[model samples]
Target: MPSIPLPGFQPPESIQEVFLNPGGFHFGTTDTRIVTLLGSCVSITLWHPRLRVGGMCHFMLPSRGVIPEGAGYDGRYGDEAMKLFLGHIMRIGAEPEAFQAKLFGGANMFADMAQRCEINVGERNIEMGLLQLERYGIPLVAKHLGGESHRKLMFDVWSGDVWLKSEQGRKPR
Candidate 1:
C-alpha cells in the first residue's frame, strides 16, 4: 500500500482509503475511510441502519438550475449532489426508510459579503438539504451546521463513526 500524507495531521495506513475532496462523494465498505473539508458548503452523511453502509457529500451550491448551461456537472450543487449521493447508497442496498442523515457545515464565512450573492448560498444550501431529506422521508439524526469557520471530517466506513473537526469544535457521532 502507498503512504498518503495528511498535512498537520497523521494519516492512517489501510488497504482501502477514500478521500472526498470538496464537491465530491464516495461510498463503499473499506478498511480505509472518507475525508473532506467544508467551508460555506454543506456536507451530508446518510447511513443505513441494517447495512451499516453510507456516503457523504460536500455540496457548495443550493440548486442546479442556477448554473448556466454547458457548465458540466457541478457536484457542489445541493439538489444535484444529494440526489446522486442518495441514489448511490440506494444502489448499494440502502433503503430510504432505513437510513438516517447527519449534516454539517454551511458556515457564514462570507459574512462580510452578506449583501452579496455569495453570502446567501450557504444558507440556501442548508435549506435545500433539509427540505430534500424531509422530502425523501429520511430523518435527520444530527447536525453541526451554520457558523463562521470551516471543518474537517473523517468518516470510518467500517465502523460508521463520524469525526467532525472544526475550529469551533468537534462533534463525534
Candidate 2:
C-alpha cells in the first residue's frame, strides 16, 4: 500500500534506517524507518503525529514475569518492550496518549504445536501487546495480527505509516 504522507512534512535529505531483530526495539525522531521480519513474534509501532517521533519493538514472548529490579529490560518480552517504549516517551517529555500505535506479526507458524499447547505463543504475544497498549492508554490505530504466513513490516516514524506485506505460500500444516 502507498504510504499516506503527513501534511506539511518534507522528506529529509537522508532518513535513518533500522532493522530490528527479534527481541530488539528502536526509538527515534522524524527521519526514521524501522523494519522487521516476523513469524510468531509480535511487533508494536508507536508514532506521535505532532512530534513525528516514535519507536518499534519486536518481542518474542508475552512476559518474563516480574523481572527483578536492577535487571536490565529485555525487548524479547512484550511487557518489557512496552516499558522500554514508555521510558523513551518519558525521556522525550511525551505522554503515552500522544502516540498512535500499530501492531503486526503474531503468526501461527507451528499449527500442530500451537493446537497441542495450552497457550499459543503468537496469540499470547498479540494479547500482551493489546493489553499493554490499553494499560498505557495508547490508542492502537491499526493492526494485522494472527495468521499462518510470515510477514515483513516497515514502520515510518516520520509519517506514522506502516506497510505490511504478508509472505504467502508457507502456511504451517
Candidate 3:
C-alpha cells in the first residue's frame, strides 16, 4: 500500500490533563494542562518560559496558625500552598526569579456577608498570594482577582497561557 501525506494534517500533541481541587497542587513539564474552578478561593500559576515547566495551586484561606507535629503541608491555606510550590521549585533546582506567575480567583461569593465579616477570605487569599509572590520575588505577569463571580481557570504549561471564563452571578454546582 502506498501512503499519501495530506497537507495541513498534523497529529495533536499529547497533553496531560489535570483537574486541580481545592487545597491541591500539580506541577509538571510542557505536556501538562491544569484546570480548576474557584469561588472564594485563589489559584496561582507559575510558569518557567525557558524550561517550559511549572505548576499551580488552589488555596482557600490566607494562612493558618501553629501546626501540629508530623503535620504535612496543606494546600488549603495560601501560605502552605506557596510553601509547597517553593519546595517543588527548589527540588527541581530552579530559582523563583526564573518563573512568571499568574493570579486568579479570590471572588467574594457572598457579597452581603463579606461586608459584615472582620476577615474576607477572598480578599485575604488574594492578599496572601500577592505577598508571597513579592516575598519570593516572582513577577506577577497577569492577574484576574477580586470579583464577585466564580471563575474557571485553565493553565497550559507548554505555552504559559491562562484562559479564564467567569461564571457571572452563578455558583458552581
Q: Choose the strongest candidate by lDDT.
A: 2
Higher lDDT: candidate 1 or 2? 2
lDDT of 1 by residue, 1-173 (tens): 22344442234356466777778877665354778888888888877655756788888888768658766556778888777866776677666767778898888777778776545666777898898798888889888888778888887655556787788533322
Residue 65, candidate 1: C-alpha displacement in angstroms = 0.8
lDDT of 2 by residue, 50-169 (tens): 989999999999999989889999999999999999999999999999999999988888888878886678888999999999999999899988878898998878788888889775
Q: Give the lDDT ranking, best first.
A: 2, 3, 1
Off by over 4 Å in 3: 1-12, 169-173
lDDT of 3 by residue, 83-119 (tens): 9999989999999999999999888888888888766
* Number of the top-ranking candidate, with TM-score as the measure: 2
- Which pairs clash in the backbone of model 1? 16-32, 60-76
Model 2 residue runs over 4 Å out of place are 1-6, 169-173
Which has the better lDDT: candidate 2, or candidate 3? 2
> Residue 27 of candidate 3: its Cα lDDT?
90
For candidate 2, give the lDDT of residue 103.
92
Per-model lDDT:
0.74, 0.89, 0.86
Candidates in order, TM-scores: namely 0.79, 0.92, 0.88
Q: Which of candidates 2 and 3 is the stronger one according to TM-score?
A: 2
lDDT of 1: 0.74
Score residue 131 of candidate 2 by CA lDDT.
96
